[model samples]
Target: MKLIAKSMLVMGMVMSLTACKKESKLNPIPTSLISDASAYDSPDRIATLVNGLYATFKGSGFFGTQYIYYSEARSGDFISTNLNPTRGGLTYQMTVDPGISDVSAVWTQGYQIINACNVFISSMEEKGIKVLTPQIANNYLAEARFLRGLSYYYLLQLYAEPFTKNNGQGKGLPLRLTPNKGLAEYNLARSSVAEVYKQIITDLDYAEANLPANYSSAALNTTRAHVNTVISAKTNVYLSMGDYANVIKEADKIVPATAPFVAPTGVKNALQTEVTAIFKAPYTTTESVFSMPFSNTDVPGTSLANAYLPDGANATGLGSAGTGDFYLFEGGIVSDPLWKTTDKRRALVFTTIAGGNKGRQWSTKYATGSPYTDYVPVIRYAEVLLNLAEALANVNGVDSRSLALLNAVRQRADQTTTLTASSQPELISKIIHERHIEFLGEGIRNADLMRLKLSVPAKTPLGSSPVPQINPENPNYLWPIPNTESLYNKDI
Candidate 1:
């Protein structure tokens, strides 16, 4: 039951020599292979391992596509047009099991990333420090820890129960900190969710302390983990735990105390005047706090565009052409009256009027055609703002700062609207609704529902495939530990 697949082991070995230099900042050329004895002998080789860690983290099975797709599809947002299990049709219907390919792939790839990080960190501790400057070595170490924490956090979200359940006393992931280099390291049991979160926070805290506050370029700022990036990620992780107080504390480290909430210290991350601008070319906006960048050469093949965009050429010319795997359900968040037609965010949705796909509406957020090189957004400044707002409302009860934070996101897309709530619950509800509208296709809905201990809302039937409402008590509410893990890891 080796968690590191033979293929991934080869990938990990090759990555040490020839990393994916998707951008000039992460350039790694094909050099002759080096054995374990000399793998961490030079600064350049160590740096290539850092870039390679990101490449693995952004694999199509992880953040590059399937993870986002699975998260959104499990929610009530999109209607599955394809019943192909290979394409996540079972996930859309909330029928994902240990045997589902996508489920198994996510589990396998996620651990691959975690193990890669462990190996990188262990190697650096053993040898990299002697070759690279202490500061450089620590920075690389922080990056690996940050990625490992993030991987565990996401895996916990889908594979385990909500952290809010009994204060994270539920079953969580195997807390594998050391490198899993061979067959003997595969029998570990799941940690309590609390223990896993403790490690996530520990890893992120180190990352925040060691990671650079900013990068030399915008691409690096968005793609690489910086101090603010670690802070932003902490805010998300805390919010998921229902730890509102800590969410506000972490968010405040980067977000301002006042309006026009640009990060004063780091990348100056603030919302774009136009929501669509963040999704357009150059995809390096301040609002894009962290994302998986893809170049024409290193694309997320058959990814977001293939799953969310329309199958043919779009009528509006926004997303151009897509595979049309799923469409906006007539009953999804788009149908809310609060989501006014005047809202600029509406442009992300394109309605088909005359074709086999007629009457169907598609999300054009990941609009890039063919090669599907859209940068997959993992966390955004806007999410930090919203997380702060939610925390504030919960902690202070209809506070002014909460109202302002909520309005900042709302008015950005729909200027004509100004939201107000008389009670704390109402304000919280409004904030949740705003999230649904703001992050419709960016993969926040399902996590939101899960964190709040809410049921997965029923989706409108597309022909005979009717997706039912999944309550929190249902076994299907949380994806099972994939057979890939269960069959191998005896502890399960």
Candidate 2:
């Protein structure tokens, strides 16, 4: 029954894509048409439709470019490197648009996905499918909530200001649960960031309560649906809320390290323990709570070959027809030796390419299969440790555990010696800086910068001198609602 509903949904989406004729511009999602109650009566079909909800979040065109990579890349962590100089300037504008294009894409895609999930949940409830127990049904809802919360989290960062509410209150994207049928719903105004966060917490709590401990099957666990990803996501939310204690608590729920730390094995670039293993693609190491796996077949442009395939570079094995996935430091800024040499993060994520590639040296970290095989990992275990360390230090200042966590990451990168102990404030500042360096391209830096109430120093590498700063006082931090939405809705 679930399968049938899923097929129908896929068919429906495909038809819509076909009618729009924009399917080629983006990856085609498997959609079906389950229009009436008669088709939904079967429990199996209902389950299938629920399953299709996961596909909506997969690497579609808009999702791949806007949500996963471009959004994070445009933030201060990375400078624009062009594979095709003539046409790449606009791509570089992502950094200056203040994430407008990325934010708009996220707003559209997230709401589309949320409506799908809500529809599935509603449909499943209507069907008396004892197929999954109540706990299981709730678990599905939790996953939906988790994804919705995540979308909102991104929106808050890109569109709203720093969290200033006493209990997480501030203007945030409108809370849209059901699909809007007309202009009335579109007439709503922005809610506070605090209000948005409360919903995020509510969704995460629901997910935590009903999700399973772990799933053995990689496809089912990592791809289909499982608990770890949701937990990892929850940890991210905790960090965003400045709730360090909860970050530690939620991360532990995923990987309970009975021992202090374990060394990484197998892969040459592996991290120290099973927990760290999640960072790598192979060996479903105990650490990965939630990661969007990119297969040569599953995702549209996440392969290494596609990402790294130079604009005119040959297609080595699979044919010379793919585009490069990884972006090198082309602005001459990403190569600053001080941070580049001392901080091993550059080496870890980007592969150094020589010969003035597109006006400056370039490298590749994603795009394993050439022209696009790069898998986009949303949440990993390493982040958990960093979050824990940062949170621990923030909550209680620099301590042994925080030091240990920070050292573990530094050691993994084969970077400089460990940081000496410092005051709570000093340690917090250091941790924040390290995190910015460590997670340069992963999309969390802008939020961290805003949350800490700190300013970006005028630097040449990624940001220019007199850095474009954002805080509660800066209207620029709060992106203008897309002009299209503004025209459609009178609230603006």
Each prediction's RMSD to truth = 6.5, 6.2
Q: Which ten residues in a row have the lowest lDDT in candidate 1?
A: 1-10
Name model 2 segments beyond 4 Å from true. Answer: 1-39, 59-63, 81-103, 128-131, 164-167, 181-184, 252-283, 301-354, 358-363, 455-472
lDDT of 2 by residue, 277-308 (tens): 34446634444434455544455433333443
Worst ten-residue run, lDDT, model 2? 11-20
Tens-digit lDDT string for candidate 1 (1-492) = 011111121112235432233421221112112235677997666676677888888877789777888998899888887777878899988988788887887887788788778888888898888987777788889999999999999988898888997899999998989875444456789999999999999999999999888777788888888889999999999999999999999998888888888898978999999999888789999999998888777877458988887766545445377767788888888889989999999988888877565677888898888888878889999999999999999999989999999999999999999999999999999999999999999888888988999999998755646888999999999999888777656787
TM-score of 1: 0.92
The global C-alpha lDDT for each of the candidates, from Candidate 1 onward, is 0.82, 0.52
* Candidate with best lDDT: 1
* Candidate 1: stretches off by over 4 Å: 1-36, 313-319, 462-464
User: TM-score of each candidate?
Assistant: 0.92, 0.76
